[model samples]
Target: MSEKKSSLIPKSALTKAWLVWETFPQTCYNYERMMGQAVAQVFSCVIYYLYKNNPEKRKEAMKREIEFFNVHVEFGACIIGMAIALEEQKSEGKNIPGEFITNLKTSLMGPLAGMGDTIWQGVVIPILLAICIDLARSGNGNVWGAIIYTVLILAGAYALSYINFMFGYRAGSEAIMDFLEKGILNKLIKGASVMGCMVMGGLIVNYVSAVCGLEIVSSAQTYSIQTNFLDAVCPKILPLGATMLIYYLMSKKRWSSLKIIALIIVTGIVGGLTGILTY
Candidate 1:
């Protein structure tokens, strides 16, 4: 039996891989492998170090890495870390199969994509934009809002990728499976969903405006339905109701956003013309 390789993968190699992924995640994007090329590129240096003694093994390893793989970039760092650890084991003459690593990567893509996209796109981006928009408006077009957003997003993306990579490297696949089996990931997703809803609700109250122009005259006194009735019943009822209606249509009825938007525009025009709804 061949003796195991004594050398360990350097942190610099892993850092380079992470940077490669961040910089060119979709640069080689295609219908065939999605992010496959990027993934292979990420591990190029690692592959060289691990299989430099065997050109055939190095080629095989590179092919395996290039197999169809796609995931949210930040959270996908965990997968990259796991792959590095697995390759190291293989290089050490451990019983790790290349197929096992490939299969694991494929299986993880969807879940990580969901988790990453939800946390970053659905929750983080909207919240950040809301704050930044408010700041810019308050500052009368201050550049700080944009600067803060750019800096924070860049810092956050790299930091998240780095942390996940290190954790996955140290913990390996067992930790990830445990995370999935224990429903911690699901719980985190649910919590993120709730927070997302709260952010959207705040955004709706802040940005979406609907005022009813409908009024009633009784006993020689005028009362705005929006002010006297709707406001008394529930503040911002029109906007809230409209927003909820849009949600219902999109979620339950499976209506396209474009259709909903068109409907809203038509309703707005008709309401304004009929003097029933106003800004």
Candidate 2:
């Protein structure tokens, strides 16, 4: 490939493409194509610039990008950047196969999605939420907590997107392959999972409140089941048990969130009326 053709994709075009991706990555999201249309949308300008002289090639390039794609939004920027690089090479008259690009995208999306979800959803969000929840509680549910969380989340998302996108563009598939080969991605996922579990445990202990109201009254004296029995056996056992039960219902029984919520409401009402539970 000639040097000029290699540099056909100007930086300005890439900036615009990134903006497009950030703004409307899922505007046409559907089961049929998932994020395919958005991928094509992100590259519309770049593709046009690369293949303006050849209408047939331009159409083919657009069609190539608009294939089935689904990945985590933040980390998916890396894939988009790689796709742009591949498109540039193809435009430079290199012998890059369309199928190769498609297959690469398909293969990378799953692993990246797993990593993205684990790190962002599992670790980062939970920690941030734990802090923000505490802040809100301390402030009696003030909007400052919400506002701070919102600002931090938006800033973090955009920053990660830009960094990953730039890295992928400059480093290409080789860098990602190196990370995978070295098991770095796996370590990150595992670490994030552990951190997520720890944060959740803390949240449960602090947030979850379940008190036993049951008491046994005898001729001589009254026995407080909660204080004398449950507390003696385990502190915060009810909260822990409740959390585990909910987790089991969701994970093992495949119960929907709405269904579980309904169950909680019913249980709360029944337990309160029967005087078996409080708080």
Best by lDDT: 1
Off by over 4 Å in 2: 1-6, 219-221
TM-score for each of the candidates: 0.88, 0.93
RMSD in order of candidates: 3.3, 2.4
Q: Kindly list the per-residue Cα lDDT of model 1 for residues 171-278, writing each as its tens digit.
A: 888888889999988998999999999988899999999999998889989999999999999998788899999999999999998999899999999999998998
lDDT of 2: 0.86
Looking at model 2, the pairs that clash are none
Candidate 1's TM-score:
0.88
Please give the lDDT score at residue 86 for candidate 1. Answer: 85
Tens digit per residue, CA lDDT, model 2, 181-229 = 8999899889988988888888888889999999999999899888999
Q: Which candidate is the best by TM-score?
A: 2
What clash count goes with each model?
A: 0, 0
